[model samples]
Target: MSTQRVFVARLSGCFVFDPAGDRLGKVRDVVVIFRKDDPPRVIGLVVEIPGRRHVFVSIGRVTSIATGQVITTGLINVRRFQQRGGEVRVMAELLGRKVYLNDGSGTAVIEDVAIERNRLGEWDVGQLFLRRPRTSASPFAKGPTTFASWSDVREQQNPGEAQSAEQLVATYSDLKPADLANTLLDLPEDRLIEVAEELPDDRLADALEEMPEEEQVHILEALGDERAADILDAMEPDDAADLLGQLPEERSEELLDLMEPEEAEDVRALLKYGPDTAGGLMTSEPIVLSADATVAEALALIRRHELHPALAAAVFVTLPPYETPTGRLLGTVHFQRMLRYPPHERLGAIIDDTLDPMPAAASAAEVARLLASYNLVSVPVVDQAHRLVGAVSIDDVLDYLLPDDWRSHDGEPPAASAHPTTATIPRRR
Candidate 1:
């Protein structure tokens, strides 16, 4: 069967199907190995399966690459896809690369790459779609975009040339925070900082929350004080407090001072608890509702795209002052139970008060036990006055219970030599 040339950008979201016509997952990226004398050869594909897990599909297993679909030989490697030393992720690492045209027309940014099957039944990068910068006289005008054979261009020679992350950020724009964080971890420090600077405050904050404390501190410090504080203001109160706890008291205080008063207050409250306690693991912004709230209202609030799945599994009912440290801890309403009740029924009527709320000072093990024993996605934490202080989600418990360096063990090995002169930022004193 003859295969037509395909542009990687067009294949980014195309679905992959097995020979049996069973849908597998969407193509997240194409992996290729660059060679010194020959064009880069396509090696495999990164397919994002359910749960946002990325797996590898060898190029040889791909029977066909048609419009809107990719048919595989049904044999796949379920292990997580780990990028090796010489392997390059076309979309993630190559899309925004700077290259010089052979004609000496100055530098152009790579916008897309085209791959075609060779006579030997192998896929190779054959063409490059690039955009040259507009002339200085017309700086405001868009640049001219053109296609050139892969061999007609060479990588930018100057080692100090500034890299722009606009295309790199665009490539991973649709990724979830956790998946985006994983991708960011693979980037060199300089590239990571560039991408972080280009990302929106909220998007960066979400990804930061999913990263390890060390990476979080590195990125937070790399960003200046103002930008760092803005990102903190956008992160969940619990996650912000946890990251701040890793810094010196003085530095932590300085950042908190720069955050918005309301946001800082929540973080400050969480900081008062022991790092391994329930309060420390609880998010100050859980789904809270008044006792008089209707089931329909509860469902609507949880349905919001912004709410985390674990946090949305249940609603906490309070007497009044619906925010954290709410008037009084009333009871909880599981989403499953809410569905069985009439839409107009008050939350109070379906409250599940059987399981007692965990104390703010409860140990990490105690919180885990409560969640496991009760099979609860989240459990409320209360102070001595029996007021709702916050709630701990299963994800929070897992982050604490897992090994400190667990994030570093995700299949990808360390490559210190890959980036010899990475930009360094001093840790907080």
Candidate 2:
């Protein structure tokens, strides 16, 4: 249950000690702990011999890093540490074990340490504070959960600056999604909902999307229908639909009713597509430009339409009778390439005949194969007549081929096959 932190200040004068308490070098600037409080806790000691760069030794590991001579349980354990003192130097030997109280967490490990001396006359101890795990690694070691930015450490130590979960609701909006996600992961689910309730819809949506699925669902369910609707509408339709799928039918219906008609319809359409298939997983709101327009005209149309959630890689081109069976899909063009063509160039001239698009009905395996072979993010779907129906976004295909649990964890598509209940493909007109 020993915790760890880095020594930022000098503790021992240049001196060396052999594993058997033998003098090595004069104790030099030894890294010491920074305790803002009356009684600063000694997390670890960094011992520096003249020829040696300071290496941290945990306070737990040190029998003592005090004056007269530096003593450590590890120095005795390792044979090379013995040496006589030359010039006196502060040395804090940080090795072996140390104890720490981080974020009210007991006995965290010291992963990494940094010292910050602010221009404003502020000094902070930066420690990659560890979290106590149910299963301790190497008897005790901090892993991913123990990571901490200096600012986080600062916030934790300054009781005056720190706020309770209730008081910090407004502050949740201040954090970036990555930071917020980490913070939320450490907080209770109920506290996260409260904080989420206070944030803007955009922040709420991003934060929710970044959270674990169970947490995301908890927030969605806790949110008022209107609040949830606003956040859902602000999210990509595919993401919105995925979150909705995790909800109770009645609640999902209520939130949908609260959403904008256009946004609701977009989500509804995505809901119709199988959660694991392109049609099920694809973004319905793609930038389907007219086949009759010139490249210039089309570009202008695209600029007017702006970014579409499901637009994938190419600007899909449909032949005459764009919606009819006779209206055949021509090809696609990268938006970047479209900007370079002369405005007068006909859309037909810019269309890349080689653009690869897969069928909406294709399996995740098939979609993955096509995606691997082509650079396009989304492949266009064509009916029996080969007319443009919809498109399969690369994200959707990835989602299809991946398992829901892993996809959520890895932020990629699920790896398992389609869900049994996800057969709700869109009906052909």
Candidate 3:
């Protein structure tokens, strides 16, 4: 094997020439085997044969790696390359991942990794070429490129190595879920799955909710059954139901079976209603307390950090049992009402019964009008028996009222301004 040092990025896409200087194939992927105690070792190259298919070229045959070209022995393996356990691909896996500087003052995305062989003939990551994130006023202007020794950067954890999705996401943790979702969309399927697997279920759920329905389904399918189900359980029941409704019945049922029974039951109920109905747009989980519960209890429920803002706008008070579809609707206590009343005041005393709940079969148009006319952020959904079943949120109503491709368009308007400054425009003009 050649002992020449070369940046994996430069080698990628470079044409391979035989000893006689005849063009053979272009480098498609650089293969490496990762080890804990030493750097990942480069093993071979996956090259795309001109008129044929991809084939494996052993590093041992390479005579030299120079700018834009790889000179190798005429001998080549005709077999197609298949990645096995412990093998990592540089261009496919590492190039686009975000990496932090060891000093923590700056960060750069791995544009390419440099690989070189030691005296012992083992390949190692020798250096890294980084592309700093763009912050210029002109979108087309390129960002500065900087080089760093592989050792000067934070550890680059390969997939199936130590599960670095969390580390990768943690670097962007300051970003809102929607912003994070945009970045995740740029990744390839396999890389997307690896990163999604490491994200906390709640975070993944939030990000998935912000993505387009097609993209959402794509990620969920890539997530596999168990992990996908866990993320669904963490999402708002209405959003979870919407996604499930888009999937095939068998796959939906499999995911539902994997979810926590309580959460699954709520989503199942939503699924029973047509996508155009009020019930389908409502989240089954909301702050529901007994009519006799104290103001302090209502305050505590509203303060729970996990409650979605729309759901937390008000606390629904119900009679007996306090379970969806079982409890009789009493009234709702707006968050402001809880704040106005003394902690010892009974919730029943402050319940606002002036506003009536919408029937489960109410059309989306009707739901929208009701919320708008009442200037309500959320309204309860009730069945024929007048039992409280769920609450339709303003966001959910908007989702139904907007055009089907509303999320796909760029710069028309933002769906949710939860973090306005961080919202990404789908394209640059």
Candidate 4:
């Protein structure tokens, strides 16, 4: 169900080739090439060949990759690639560069370089896979591997040059939001902070929301108050409140002063509620629209805003003052249901009236009951005024009630001791 990607460590040793099925060789090393003044990119892969020569392949010209093999089509041959001056880049030089594979389709980090044996009894690169793997069953956080796997990448090129630790941090841009979330959690704290600083603000917020609360603290704490405030400014109001609530109250006031008044006030509103209560768990952002507009206009808003179709599927179509967050709540319109109507149909004409909604002040247990009944990962929360206040996600409830229950259902044996955990809940807030 999660579209999360893995780290590039998994795709370290894929085979390589050009047109005509001419075997070029496998990736020997990967090198990241960021600006001398900036972080390194794991952008180049050093290829090993049958002859005494090697070449570095860029993200371009990468046609496709299957398992451990890289497929590319080009006018030039392997011989010309070597003569172009990329002989010295071995896997030892590119430890932490970013790799923007396949013309920047996605991103990934270099975790480790793996080597395997070829059919001729000679050692060759095998697969360039991403590092981290995720499952809903894992404890509140994910497990680890320094080198990422290829599956974590949304797109990738053939055998990329191997990297050595001394080279610099590698960045891969080919991952989806969820994938980036897992990778961030899996990365070492220092490395994760660097990636977090580079991520787009909205995306950084989404990834943080999907992340376990513990990791949210680790990354923010590492960034210190100044940097953390910059990222928090871009997060949804409720999410920002939730994150701020996890820190010591003394630190909260200092951070509040650092935020803009509007952003600060939105977070303060949610901070007033107990974390386990529905009010504490609602999100303050929504793609709301007037209920009287033509269905066409409402649909246009969704596309223009680039909102998640699932979250904005049913526009909370209200009445009047389309420009302002208003007081009237006329009704709701399912995006698909609206699309089926004639282009001239009004939103109110096509609205459904049978939906049951929850109040913001309800306990999570009550909200869960509704979610279970409706099979929803998220549910809207409205205030005493009937206006939408926030939304709650399934993970929030599970964290409070079933952190360890899932492991029992999974029939997992006693956990390995690499990561120790406490049974008694800590009183932090």
RMSD of 1: 8.1
Q: For residues 61-179, could you state the per-residue lDDT of candidate 3 as single tens digits?
A: 67777658988775665444556767777765777667778887577777768888788765677778787767798968766889887666775556765333433554446557765
Q: Identify the superior model by TM-score, candidate 1 or candidate 3.
A: 1
Tens-place lDDT per residue, model 1, 100-213, is 899987889988989899888789998999989876676578688999988899985577777667788888888888889977876666788989999999999999998889
Worst 10 residues of 2 by lDDT: 87-96
Name the candidate, 1 or 3, with the larger lDDT value: 1
TM-score, candidate number 4: 0.56
TM-scores for all candidates? 0.80, 0.52, 0.62, 0.56
lDDT of 2 by residue, 308-354 (tens): 43463467777665532226788887777777877777777778878
Q: Candidate 4: global Cα-lDDT?
A: 0.56
- Residues forming the 10-long window of minimal summed lDDT in candidate 3: 420-429
Clashing residue pairs found in predicted model 3 = none
Clash tally for model 2: 63
Query: For candidate 2, what is the lDDT?
Result: 0.54
Write the candidate numbers in order of decreasing TM-score: 1, 3, 4, 2
Model 4 residue 72 CA deviation in Å? 23
Per-residue lDDT of candidate 4, residues 1-429 (tens digit): 322221234444566766556665665444443233322333445554443234445534455544566665532223213312232232333344445544443555454444332343222222343334334575666433443333333323357543223222233355455545754554444555766766666667777866667678877777767777877888777778888888999998888888888788878888987887887876655556655578778777767654554456667655544322335555667677887898779877777656655677799899889878976666666667766665566755665676633322122323322312211122210
Worst-scoring 10-residue span by lDDT in model 4 = 420-429
TM-score of candidate 1 relative to the true fold:
0.80
